[model samples]
Target chain A: MVTAVRAWPRPAGRAPAVLGILCTAVGAAFVASLAVGAFPIGIGRIVEILADMAVPGNASGSFDQDAAVLLSIRLPRAVLAVCTGAGLGMAGAVMQGLFRNPLADPAVIGVSSGAALGAAIAIVGVSLLPTAFRVAGGFLLPGAAFTSAVITTALVYRAGRQDGASGMHSMLLAGIAFNAIAFAGVGTLSFIASDEQLRNLSFWSLGSLGQASRDLVMTSSIAAAVGALLLWRLAPALNALALGAAEAAHLGVDVRGLERRAVLLVALVVGALVAATGVISFVGLVAPHIVRLACGPDHRIVLPGAALFGAALMLAADAVARTVAAPAELPVGVLTTAVGAPFFLGLLLRARRASGL
Target chain B: MRGVLLAACLTLAVTHASAAPPARVVSVGGAVTEMVYALGAGTALVGADSTSIHPSEAGRLPRVGYMRQLSAEGVLSLKPALVLATAEAGPPAVLEQIRGAGVRLERLHVRHSPEAVRENIRTIADALGRGTAGDALLQRFDADWRATRTRIAGLPTRPRVLFVMAHGGAPMVGGRDTAADAMLELAGAANAASGITGYKPLTAEAALAAAPDVILVTDQALEAGGIDALLQRPGLALTPAGRAKRVATMDAVLLLGFGPRLPQAVDELATKVRAW
Candidate 1:
């Protein structure tokens, strides 16, 4: 269930408090994600491990399983969650603003479907790659996914663009068509794939933080940071564009340029995020809405606020995924969708009630 | 011979802890778990993945999750000195993390062949320091395999068999490059679905055209709907196998696991085919 955007009267005075609360929540979730896991590392022990690792030359000869689990397994996974969540959240806010519509997210630009197609191809064709190429096989899936996502977005943009004005309306339609095509491609691959390949493809689609590594986290963090900073800089432009493209143009905002830049930035950031995390749904579509409901529709606060909130939400979901089944972890994406869909439905109902519709 | 023995010891030392067998072991693959139990090291198993359902006792061990999607923390939580996994067990990084935690990790080079079974048993045996037990198991497996080959060689006809795996959706028939195909080949039978590779949904035309003399299904598949229900499907009902009701069902794991019990599986399937 979804509803069209209603410009909530700006709660300008309360924005700072909301941001502060979100920041604190994110910090808490990060600590919790680090401390709780399948292995029973107590909070005190976690803190001690943290302190031990902080000191120079403390890399002990004795392989401490607790420390390895904390550092190698959970820490990178948590960091990846934060980076991916933040990128998806901010991208969602930007898409909602740029399109002047509430429902627009990266999927509206075919990023998710394109990434899925690319990943399916990689999974099925990986054995065909030369041994030398297969040695770096870990990167191949994400690399292909990212490349295809950008290409899909670019094609959609081209198809949507007409005259000099940004055809945001047609872009949405093109995205829908492309998404179907890409998904069909993925379906065909699944039919032809071996059982193992099918398993890999399904796992990739379900999404997990299990594949997280320091390098993946590092790359995602840089991409998310860049997207957030650049998008945050364009917050004022986005704010103006929110008041109808024609009206914003009259007020000296370059409406066409803003739409182009916003779509490109969202594609780049969300592509990288999806490639790393394997199609985590709901965070991008719902995170910004949650922030806007809390602090009103102000891009400046909504951007950072949504990013922090999304990071917190992802950390909490990932924590549950890691611990709920103990040794058998649930896919983090499944947990997010399970929790997010209901919460989103509730939001839609509340919005309808508030609007007296 | 001394040089070979010396090289073996040196290899073992580098891969495993020096001269001492691991006190506790975690088995990640079903076949790996089977070998561990068959080698008389079952008591040493502290944890196993979800696929390790064979041997009954293995099912009682603490589950570490699916073999392919293992968690490092879960495996480490078992506090095992060694982890024995089939080559298929991983997200790769998880395996590396387990190794980094100073655990001896042995990944068997598995394939759908008897040679691989011998190699896996030998590797698992050496890893568990049960070299004598490994030899005995190998001898028993070889004898059974030789007897099976002899029986199949004496057979007059190689029947056409189809392996239909039905679980909820449209039933998929096993084709070329599948473990089912390998099993059929070993059991003095030709695969009816050899035209296609892997598993594909059984089309009415394909099923009728294959004209199998015997239809093979998993025990679990047969449980879902009886042999009558399977044979009643439109495509299957017209086939020679369906007309005669010559359907054989076997435990899916034992049939496809390609582990120590592979000889038993092949022999059983072949005997059933001959009887039909």
Candidate 2:
């Protein structure tokens, strides 16, 4: 059904304007995210509270609950949401470009499942680990997830290589196979886990931005920013990649080198983001498609456009997650799908109608 | 063990602190909330996590989400003076954020033992400045516990009890180290599935092999699938308990909550098993 709307008109000249509008939408969503939560602080009060933090010696001379909530809880969470969404969106775009398939997303490379298996192991085996590892405590799940994602990516890349040359079909097949294996590993771990540990695993798998902290936001922001920037710079090569690998090679693009860098960069960005937030489904898969359907197949525009749209989408979804249920929050991953799917479907319908399909 | 020591030391630390007792409290664990109510400090509870379902009044309080997946803003919205949580309540980062926001958070150690329950009661009582009430409640609990133990000790034999929780998929049997197992032991009964380390799905062979005299089921599980349906499962019908139709059902929270109601739960189970 989606394939019926595949032929979008190439409006290359409007790229800069679309990117600008997307950037502004992301900014507005970030502000809205901070303004809404279980705690109700008016927009004016939110501005004043944030502005006070910027100034020196502005303690209101009393315990400020609003300021405490706005600063410690909402601010870091919003920042982390933006960083994570940006990373996932950019990685999705790169994967689609590298694979030459519009449906491909970051998960196609085995990141999500690999992370799932790693986190499952950490949850089920934490008690048996030595004190040194046990003492790491809070970092254990995320660290294991990130490490395994990298390992799985490396394995996928190595297995897909034939006599010093990388093949896209082989790589895709390897990823699908690894995903199945990883899922089975997770199932086995679930079978052995204690009740509390099983609850933790389910919560982790459902994803949430509620765990955002200053340290996590700082590190993930840097990683996402670096990865996004590097990928953005490679846009031209990626566009060349769209003309088929053999054709791109004849035109002076090093197909194998580009593929290696793309895979590595996506793994780094996606691994960090997913490790922090758990498995946030739909964003990576849907964000790029929405961008391409709106604009064109040009990677230069699609890459940045998807990242901005993804950031906005996550910010809006997370805000709803924390507010819709009041004090009892829904998982953000659930909200993302609930929010993204209908909106994505609407866009597809419009695309089909416009194409006379 | 470290968590137990930490909770013990924190209890002492709270005892020494002379700060005014909190007027607004948020409780994150089910057991912690029960203790708060038992100490007559329920009036101070402005919010509680989803697990806090007992006392009926706790259900009316604003919910701050599940203990493990807490939202800092949700808890802070109540503007609580103090937050009482089990050591298990956390994604870890949210707890740190709540602390950073200047809320006093006390994490009580929870284990499936009467002593752990007593420690929690003491910790909550001290934190709420209800030490006199705590002492009276402890005395009453000891009396009930001693009486129950004496009654159980006079029994001719300890029944091999199986705990089957069947909310979804295959029914899982509680084994050694589980709260269900500990509760059975406290009730002067042997755990049928003690050979397994924790909870494991009941295979027909394993269920037949266990051959428990009495089966205990959570009220929630019983509600999901009736007692007849449960007994009719694969190898369950072949078990001694199933053939005899001897099943005991109790609220999971009451039997496993490990709070102020621990003695009452033990007394109830001991009575039921002794009668059989």
* Per-residue C-alpha lDDT of model 2 across residues B112-231, encoded as one tens digit per residue: 898888888888888877778889989988887788778777877899999998887878899988988888998889999988978888899998899999989989998888989998
lDDT of 1 by residue, A55-89 (tens): 97877777677888888888888888898888888
Give the runs in model 2 whose Cα sits over 4 Å from its true position. A1-11, A56-63, A164-166, B1-20
Please give the lDDT score at residue A190 for candidate 1: 89
| DockQ values, each candidate | 0.57, 0.59
Please give the lDDT score at residue B218 for candidate 1: 92
Query: What lDDT is obtained when candidate 1 is compared to the true structure?
Result: 0.86
Q: How much of the real interface does each model capture, measured as fnat?
A: 0.60, 0.74
Any residue pairs clashing in model 2, and if so which?
none
